[model samples]
Target chain A: MEPWTTAPAGPSSAPEMPSPGGNPVGRVEEVLAQFFMDGKLRAAATDPAYLTLWEALEQAVAGGKRSRPQLVLAAYQHLARPAERAAENAVLLAASFELLHSAFVVHDDVIDRDTVRRGVPNVSGRYRQRALRDGADADTAAHAGDSAGLLAGDLALSGAYRLLRRVRTAPERRERLHDILDEAIFASIGGELLDVELSRSPVMPTPERMCRTARCKTSVYSFEAPLEAGAVLAGADSSVVAALTSSGRHAGIAYQVVDDVLGVFGHHSRTGKADWGDLREGKRTVLLAYAATRPEWQHIAHLIGSPHLTAAEAEHIRRVLTDCGARDHAISVAEDNARRALDFLEHDGVPSPLRAELTALLQGVMDRVRPE
Target chain B: MEPWTTAPAGPSSAPEMPSPGGNPVGRVEEVLAQFFMDGKLRAAATDPAYLTLWEALEQAVAGGKRSRPQLVLAAYQHLARPAERAAENAVLLAASFELLHSAFVVHDDVIDRDTVRRGVPNVSGRYRQRALRDGADADTAAHAGDSAGLLAGDLALSGAYRLLRRVRTAPERRERLHDILDEAIFASIGGELLDVELSRSPVMPTPERMCRTARCKTSVYSFEAPLEAGAVLAGADSSVVAALTSSGRHAGIAYQVVDDVLGVFGHHSRTGKADWGDLREGKRTVLLAYAATRPEWQHIAHLIGSPHLTAAEAEHIRRVLTDCGARDHAISVAEDNARRALDFLEHDGVPSPLRAELTALLQGVMDRVRPE
Candidate 1:
């Protein structure tokens, strides 16, 4: 089977082709795969053991559709003197984005103590299993789990650097790209650190704070950096850069809030993971916004934090969240953000074709955030 | 008191200065202190929480003498035209070396689950204590310890990249420096993984294989990378680079083996840490070379894995090591490597000043290795 065939949702329902041509998204994925394969070879050469780490990274990159990279290339083509060189830089940028994503996921898995990810044992979890299979005692296996997972994350971090080194653009453009990436990563880690600490404390996570965290941790790199890098390479003016970043910030946060919603209520078949894993883990999300404003939530808040809450109890808590209107309120917030993102893009001078594509992408993502 | 004044071991017996009229090694310590204070301010601007991570990194970096960076600067001075610009590059390089060292040590402590490092509670250990002190339950505290430690190491890793970005050299030279740093980090992690694995299986860590691990893990970055980067900045020839790398390979391995010895029987006042911490933690070192070869040692091989081995038991093992001539063998190996390092520098046309400094630095390290 093709690597993309194994995506949690099998395949997305978005149109494969642009109006005037063939399957642009599929072509993007094909190009991304080849670019990633080359980057993987270079990463593997960092050390012999990185060969194994690279395999894990490939799986992580393969599961995502080529939406982000396609957006970058589409935008670049709209703004730049499109050529083979432009196409090549887009692929390199896409590959670097994938590497950056892998770094975050690997580190996130460790923080979340997640044993399985994307329907496969997470890197650290796999290492733990290998130790057990090797007849290591319990303590040894546990230590091996933590260490291996950590090293795996470090390897991924290094892989992102290696990818950046391969950017064949002008040195000044490359340096700007590097700065954008470095700043985003540093901020993301800080945001993650704040996020985990907030979850551990008794304070109710505000919707505003959650949105801020989402923007820093997920939005910038996920939506803004890729687009900004592409635009910078295309020598887009300051106004275009500002507009894209604004759109990306709002849209990315909306995407994350929607993801949080899906984490609690989406189908296991579509997500390819346990439904309500977030609830089971007591994760704080934007859906808690209504609860924070409601006096009735006090009783349920204590219940949610109860040390002995069972899966059925977690289901009841989820029901209470819906009953208090938090779930719907979160969806509304996400819709507003998505709408704002599209509204911001309308002021930019993006070419008609690409602007239409951006509009559709934003609306499609918003439409999918559902209670279904 | 200034942090340097409280350095774990005051002045470390004042290793003989490498240059007759140059600044004392204390100047290196002062430079480290200044860099750390500036690093703290930069980290605080990013996030106040990062200040904690920076302090942990500073502590780790401060404990070691400025051997490797000094070697790099000394080599640079030998070849480079005397200029303020060159001196600035040398300091930046020295700071980079320290940052790389800090990254390695932070990660190493996590891998080892070390509770105390350089006579202070390790970052992980301190976090665990703080969690418990703050009334976190046992499991929560344990998890916090592991998580915080992992993140702290990541902080150091990120900080290294930030330091590297400031290397204002030719793009080609910068790329070469970047490659050296990247390769050293990956290889060191790989060697550490191997060492941890081998400890559980109880194999004869052959001198050659162990030395190779040292060369890759310690020597290349610690010595070769800095020296090569300096040379590239100074525009040195291939012959100088070759001799430097070869000599570094010998000294680096010898330094680690000597460090392993000191861990077993060194003075508390001089090393500024528990003399037998390695034995208590069951680290497999070259000092075990003698113990592993003894008939008497076979009886206690299982006990070596015990976490609760006492001071007396550790001393007994040390005695067995002395009796088996393994200690003597390790010393001989160190001396041989030291000689080889010097011999490698005995070329017809090396910069005379650099050769003398390299000779002094190698001897200073070798002098600390005691015979059985």
Candidate 2:
């Protein structure tokens, strides 16, 4: 039911113990839920029309496994001096990351033309269905849904900043948080633009280009920013921040690799997404880049990006990818990145207990993508 | 050529003299221009792909008369203690308002399906043209253009916050600025969503609803927030803030009223936009609401909201609006609001010179739509 559960659930993994904040994941969720409720109430008082957007936003933010939030809180707990105010602010900071993620996902759905997310009708889907029920034509319905989704995303992004502003930290620290958030947003946007360009280009993307795109689009925002923001708020030294950045970058790249793998190989029931989406959309993943260099790929290349790619064609592409060693290469790369991430935690002077918790979380994420 | 030149240029109006820190408008533009140039260089260094987005953003921010920024600086100058750092910070704050305005307009263009803005190819239009020249089909090109536009707006919104964070203000004052910005953004977004809903609904939107939309969508961010943010940064008392808010609300509403009038009757040569857009788009302006109550509207009502509305038909609708007294009524409402705004400035303890300057600015805006 977690938002990051976009990957197929692998082995019932759980954290060993709660951090200093006591169940950071649960606290993050509670904070977000309350935030939405309060926001919805305010909107309702002003105008009921605004309620629809709030409802859509609420759904978008809900049911997340709170992955990003966990990283924020764990990092803060590890480095921050013991202060009650900082502890409270950490929860808010964690919630801000979740809000940011929701914003990205909502917009991503519009770009991907996706109707469902997290195994349920997404924000666009719900609005689209409503428009249809009200007798709007398909085109009108789609436009309405997309517009609403776009607005919802905007609200969430703005809300993230608002939440961060509420964190009762020193002015200097708050200023640093703002810088980190801004850089992440700028980089992620660049990554998305690059992604759109790569998708449309006739030239095959290089593996390095693909990796760079992944790091920019997913790694920085999803991993590095949250980790760094938490550490900065906690007044951690530059070395700790740098170490977390390294760890976040590698883990984030690994996460995207696994995501690409799931798109082709993971079951729909488990991943809660179309299994053939990446191939059908011709997503320029590193796996696809590696396959393009193989002679065997030439035979099925025509079938790869076809909009009407069937289950049989998907199966053929999967088989061809494995036979050409592209799939194994991608999986091995993910494993190597995950190992490097763990190595950072091991060598860095992080507190022992916090280090163990961080290790467990990263391992759990990696396990979700291990080759059967 | 300034974006805030929403009003058609009249008999060459100019400020009497520069404030304590010289021409605030000139300073704001310089800051913004430098910011964009620096941003472009950094983006280019990161990736050439990022350059396209920054270019689009630059165009979007350029040519604005710095209307919102002017309000920010003018308000700040009226009350701020004579401190060198405060003056410098005011310019940065003014630039932030411009950034936020750019963000809104970029997104608004996408929502309105407007390819041209200020009588030129807007961000989406430019990108769409590029995509087509690059061999993408019409649909792909349009989608690509919109997606890129969406990202550009996101960057601008984030960039606004980043710019504000650069303002050298006390922590408490900075917090207040954040609050004002957040509230304005939230209200404007809600107003936009309401506008979309009102447009699509088969029922006639009430005049009250239309006015509410105008105030929320235009007044808060465009008038009220800039004024309030500037005042807050200058450490103005709550009463002064309240007075400015009142002036802003009435003036902002008046601005929208004039804008609605121009949409119908203003020549494209003067307005830099299509005269028939509001009619074709079926914009639910207060003038339209008033016209709907008149019997004369029944004859040509069918012509309104037609996607293929012709120039001749637009001319006929304009005539009908006049004959029914809706156009005159709208203008009178606008004048009344402007009068109310002037009343606030006269009664409120704004400095004499600054008050006179503010009055002249507001009068210039009101004159833009005075009935011939």
Candidate 3:
């Protein structure tokens, strides 16, 4: 059987299969699109100024893989057969995750001073370009872009809670959902702060610290929180919630590991980010930590964080990373995490069909990170 | 009767009346102190890094007159005879307001590039100092400070919601509180964004636009939302809520108008900010708008928004504003707003005792801005 036939559709699956029958991802996209339209109308009714804010928000949230929302909806579907109202609530919950993700993305771009995302000028970049076109000097234009981006992110953050408030659920369940979201947001901010600090610190961080950063920054929001939010909305039992939480934690770590690996090795066309961007930024990744243990690092350490690092230098770094076994180490860690996620699902008594689906989905993600 | 004897204790009242029988503001301070202690403990338990964040947030919140929280608690006390549980819930709601305010203050410093607040280094300033001490370049230090301040604000914003979630109120009432807060946050952010845009634009904003910005930025959160939150917690009727909202809106506008006036004319020792800071930043206040219509403005227009504006230049601009009648015009507008607020309270049938207290409180605040 084809991979997607046996598993839920994910990033690698049928791109043209819009609303492919049982696909929750397609439904999530539809919900997000409708939400954008409704938001536009609301903004228009309020003030013309808000209309620009809503437009920028819409753009910031657009054209992603919808992975976080997918996790929410899929987790909900796997746990319960919801009635119509419950199903709608699931979509709102899913949309809230997307909004939260957008908040992080917009702010992250500003902090990283990144102008492009997904191969296009991001929210800040678009604003910067507009200001420059309107005759602002470079410094003024940059400040305007950062201000616009900062406010857009704030709107998205607040909008996430607003969306959650509108989700029609029992007050108790809604309260629980708010708790999960609050914790995730707190953890994510902590992680982002730590990441900033580590990047600037003169001393290199320990591998343990790096791993903790990954968990705080990526896993909590990207996996554990969304999965838990879905389970709470579904009124899943404690055992099921715990199982999914564990499963998601491991899977999230795997996702980040794979992401770090792809940051250096994946083709620019495939990743839609500059292949050397992470290296240029001197990001502290698991691959980098592993490579630090190798003798090969000493020769090219000075070139690692140079903004003007040439393509040839990057190619040399990539070769050194592979030869020093750092690339293989990262892949193995991802595979290990993927297995651990499946193990939790199996032993923690997730229903058989759901377990099979999660396992297959995780396997598909892991497949992309495996060495050819 | 003396203002303190007739009205609630405010900033201008006795500082040593710690728990003078019915002092809501005193209780707010006590509650905020305890909350900070609890937050520090919680952060210590989580990670040492977060200790810095908690410390910065504590400083940002410290030294405020507790005016916003005072509004929340005082409004609640006047509207309803609360049981012990209801009283505790009121304090929680009040603290949430302070958290929201802190969020705005920290982010505002980043947006305005202001290094000092309340006569001391703000959260961003502290972080920037630390980065510089660590020997980072000026640009890197500034970026680091901004990133830290940005995340700290996000934490405080999220913490506001977290505190609200813990309030032990009826679910319906809690929902209403969330709605009020969400609207306030949305409005405040809109106002802040507009302020940034106006300051950056070469063209001057209209007086109407300036007023709208004040309403959206200051009045909504500072006055309207806190009052509404208190009333909702007290289960006040819709008419009462509407009356208070109107009263708060006018009071808030007057407060901002007074603040703008002080930004230019007040002594630095009294205002705890540079007297010329607003002029240097070229804030488009109603005072500025009114002055723009006068022929005298033509001579001093170039002096506005100059980063290196001297005390002499600022004094010259101040004289021009007075000579052109802009200062008088702004004071008149503020007085009008203050009167409207009192009028709303009287006509809206706020109980006699509460009406007296609110009137005296607003009058006390207005006295500071009234022309000598």
Candidate 4:
């Protein structure tokens, strides 16, 4: 059930493997199972074809690292420490993050036109294959697949918010939870729109703009929102929650910066994704943005974004990126953001164990680009 | 601001003309304008391209008949009459439906490969046009358009749910409000997926299945859910609410049936939609489903889904549908559902004026096909 049950994830599917990183991940899975079971029942209650959709979602959520939910738990523990697990409702809150992430991933696949996820056929890919098998021509089959994917993404996204209704908390806290959900979803969509706009733009996007897009895309949901919700559920002091969320924001940017770097330069076996895909797609990555400003960019500008580049051409492009120092500058940006994420450790409210955990996580993000 | 300001909507963009048949629509627009202004600010807070997405949404919502929101108000006034308005929160709830509908329209455009909405360039259309203007090829332009459409749709959909947060209500009733939202969105997405699957399906869909699809697609949100939410907000008795909802469900089925018929046989000037697009798209309409069971179907089955279907060929298909009695049968189904909707007039809880309104509404749905 962990993916690669078909075709592994491409560049955008982060945390390709779930990390058992001392978070209460198992309970989150329980919440997800219950949530998805209800959705599957309702979706398929009328038609069996819809059941296939929920089934794909089940596989999609099962494949992630569960890092976002872990942030929820970690933030909760900073306030409700020594309590092995957050309450059931809080776990549902955490589960909502994973559900929303799955929604974004499914939708992202449609946007990027990627047919695979987590080494398996994504929602779009599966539907496309089925349509093809059913004898439709290529174009119609693809269209059918994307349509199904769009609807599936809707189900998951709505289901994510619906999951929040089951969580019982104080009224004010509930408002905060809704607010967090709104912010995360809103910011992430804005980020996604920015990414799409930047990629197809005739003018090259600035590195600053790319970084802003990356931060917006991943920060609020993957880090700030979930963590803030967790703290709210724990009834943590407002100041503590704010500072912790700020830390999460920086970490989100760092995480994305590392992800963008990994999309191009990380070892395929290590990162669990194909390298140079970002380059070939003409991605609005900080690395590329930096390279475009450098003199060496002229030599390989034509080679990038070509659908049929040979391995030699890719190698040449990568060497140019490295020689031009764009790769190093991007790495340093990741390092700076990661360092900033750790700045919250000495704050009065952050617990010692939480501090240790944050250190480990930031180190992990940096290690992606650091490991020789 | 009704749809077709540009290409008009195709078969699926129902309620092309916002009927001003005595519903409280003015306030709904005010709410929509305020909601979108906030969204535009947040979306464009970082980038101008993002602002264009919100602007497209503004036009999309403005273009609809606002019938769904009208349903909410109509239902509310039935329960809480003698008052000029139901309440502000209820108005927010009504507006949420229109927002959600706009979200669906935007996404539906993408799924159907439609680039126009409300007679103007849709979110996708605008984005794709810009890309083309920026020198992208047709394929890239189309992809860029669809991608933006996807994100725009997500914003509106998520915004719809977020709008629910602003409506202050009692806890239990709030739960019911949430429930209605869930049911409406879930049922609608399921309906959409079914439509997509049926159209591409190798096996011809039965008339019964097509009827079910139309009912699911239009009933819950456009009629039943809004009606139920209105009753809930007014704190009407559970039985009364249920009866009202049952009527709404019937009316919705009738509405869709009339819509399908109008898509083919209704005069273009009357319906504000092209008459033969459904036939050209091989839509799994109940009329087509019924016709497929008859002898005359063979005369035009090949031309049913053909893209190059000529006006004369379309006329032949229309005559075949009518001559085979399929058209009559479809009309009767619409009438039956419309009549069932009127049956609620006699329900114990329905006030006199409300009953009169419901009757008129049902007759209106029937009139689309009857106008001749």
- lDDT, candidate 1, B132-211, per-residue tens: 88788876777666666777666667656666677688788788778877776667666665566556555766566566
Candidate 3 per-residue C-alpha lDDT over A1-372 given as tens digits, one digit per residue, 9 for 90 to 100: 001111123454433112212436666677778877876786666457667877887887874556677678767876765453377788888888888888888888888877676656878898889899989999888888887888888888987887887788777888899888987887788778878887887565666677677777888898899888988888888888888998988987887777778778877655556788788888878888888878987866777778899999999999999999989988888888888898888754477766766676676567666645
Clash pairs detected, candidate 1:
none
Determine which window of 10 residues in candidate 3 chain B has minimal summed lDDT: B1-10
Worst 10 residues of 1 chain B by lDDT: B1-10
Q: Which stretches of candidate 4 lie over 4 Å from their true place?
A: A1-20, A81-86, B1-23, B81-86
lDDT of each: 0.67, 0.80, 0.77, 0.79
Question: Using alpha carbons, what is the TM-score of model 3?
Answer: 0.92
What is the per-residue lDDT of model 1 for residues A48-69, given as tens digits with 9 covering 90 to 100? 4445655655665566555556
Model 3: which docking level applies? Answer: medium
DockQ of each: 0.35, 0.70, 0.59, 0.78
lDDT (Cα, tens digit) per residue for candidate 2, span B50-86: 8878998898788455778888888888788776336
> Candidate 4, B140: how far from true, in Å?
0.8
Evaluated on the second chain alone, the candidates' TM-scores are 0.85, 0.92, 0.91, 0.92
Error of 3 at B104 (Å): 0.8
Between candidates 1 and 3, the one scoring higher on lDDT is 3
lDDT of 4 by residue, B1-372 (tens): 111222234443333333424666787788888998898898788788778878877877777766778778777877874553447877899888888888888888898888765457788898889889999999899999898888888988988898877888779988989888988888888788888888887567988888778877777777889889988888888888988898988888877877778778876666555678788888888888998898877788788789988899889988888899988999999899888888875788887767776677676567657744
* Candidate topping DockQ: 4
Q: Candidates sorted by lDDT, descending order?
A: 2, 4, 3, 1
- Clashing pairs for predicted structure model 3, backbone only: none
Every model: Cα RMSD to truth: 4.5, 3.1, 4.7, 3.6
Runs in model 1 lying further than 4 Å from the true structure: A1-9, A12-68, A305-308, B1-9, B16-67, B83-85, B289-297
Q: Output the better candidate (3/4) by TM-score.
A: 4
Off by over 4 Å in 2: A1-5, A8-22, A83-85, B1-22, B83-85
